[model samples]
Target: MTCTTAVLLPGTGSDEVFVRAAFAGPLREAGIALTAPAPPPDGTALIEGYLAAFEATAAGVDGKLLVGGVSLGAHLAVEWALRHPERCSGLLLALPAWNGVPDGAPASVAARISADMVERDGLADALRIATDGVAPWLAAELNRAWPRHAAGLAAGLRAAGAHPAPTLDALAQLRVPVGIAACTDDPVHPVAVANAWAAALPRAHVRETTLAALGEDRAALGRAAIEAWQQASASQGSD
Candidate 1:
């Protein structure tokens, strides 16, 4: 199947703006149109919003859609693909936080902690703590995104923190080609998780980049994911 459109979702507490910046250029160069929807206002509806957006977008498309996203968004994309494999052409997952139950994964823990901070200290203080030790680019990104969430931010974080990604066993059942991108230096979203996902999926490839590179160029992560997807798709054709 030739997929010309990709519908991507944002990570926990993120919005479509960042998603566009991260993926639009690379996907455009690859001849794929990008659809990045604004997250729902209610944080608790994050997953539902993403799934609904995918369904709505896929409805107007001619063929199967390419689907994926970053962090929690990637998890939701996989979940949607598993449920509707016939409508999905492939995956372009970036920075998958964990497989199966979060089990105190760094990303999960961080989300939970941030949620608590937002509730206890309010958004301003929470944002300060959240961005305190992050890279400048990351901090800037968060500073811009976190404010948008505002009152709903804690709910969104808590929802994401509690949600479970597809397990490795479940992943093995997904036959669609998958391209996973991982940041070598991202402790929150460890590279090992991406490697494990690639190992489990029948038609999958993993590409590595660094957070430093990502900071220097927003498109770095998207380029890695697109390249990995191309490799996976080619391998599928050969098979």
Candidate 2:
């Protein structure tokens, strides 16, 4: 399928600003227009809001869409695609946190912890606690995005922490090509999870990068996912 447009979403407490920075250039170079929607402020409705946005965006397009995103965003994209397979061309999943249920996964645990902190200590204090001991680039990203979430930050984190990603069995049903990206050095989003996703998906490839590379250039993650997608697409075409 020819996909000229991509609708990418952001991770927990993240906004379209980060999504655009990560994917806009790479997608532009690939001649694909990108729509990075701003997530709704109400955390309770995040999943539904994201799905609605995807549907609305796809409605305006002529052909199937390249749908995906980072972390929780990636999970939600898969959920949407599973429901509307014909509308999806492929996936560009980055930093998949876990398979099946959250099940106290590292990412889920951290999200829950962060949510608790945000609720008890407020955004500024929670951010300090969350960013502490993290890489400067990551800290900077949280500082930039977290405040925008403000009052809804805790709810959003809790909602994401509780949400389950597509299970391995469900992934097997998705015949579309997928490109998964994993950060080799990032513990929050384990590479093992990405590998599991690749193993379950019918036509999927994984490209590994490091958090340091992503820190130096936001496009590093996007490039990894796109490269993996390209490989999957080539393999699918060959078959």
User: What local lDDT does model 2 show for residue 80?
Assistant: 93
For all predicted structures, in order, the TM-scores are: 0.97, 0.97
Regions more than 4 Å wrong, model 1: none
- Kindly list the per-residue Cα lDDT of model 1 for residues 202-231, writing each as its tens digit: 999999999999889988998999899999
Q: Candidate 2 — which pairs collide?
A: none
Model 2 Cα lDDT, one tens digit per residue, 1-239: 47899999999889899888888998888888999999788888888888888999999999899999999999999999999998899999999999989998999999999999988998889889889899999999999998887677888888898999999999999988999999999999999999999999999999999999989999999989988998999987722
Against the reference, the lDDT scores of all candidates come to 0.91, 0.91
RMSD of 1: 1.2
Indicate the worst ten consecutive residues by lDDT in candidate 1: 230-239
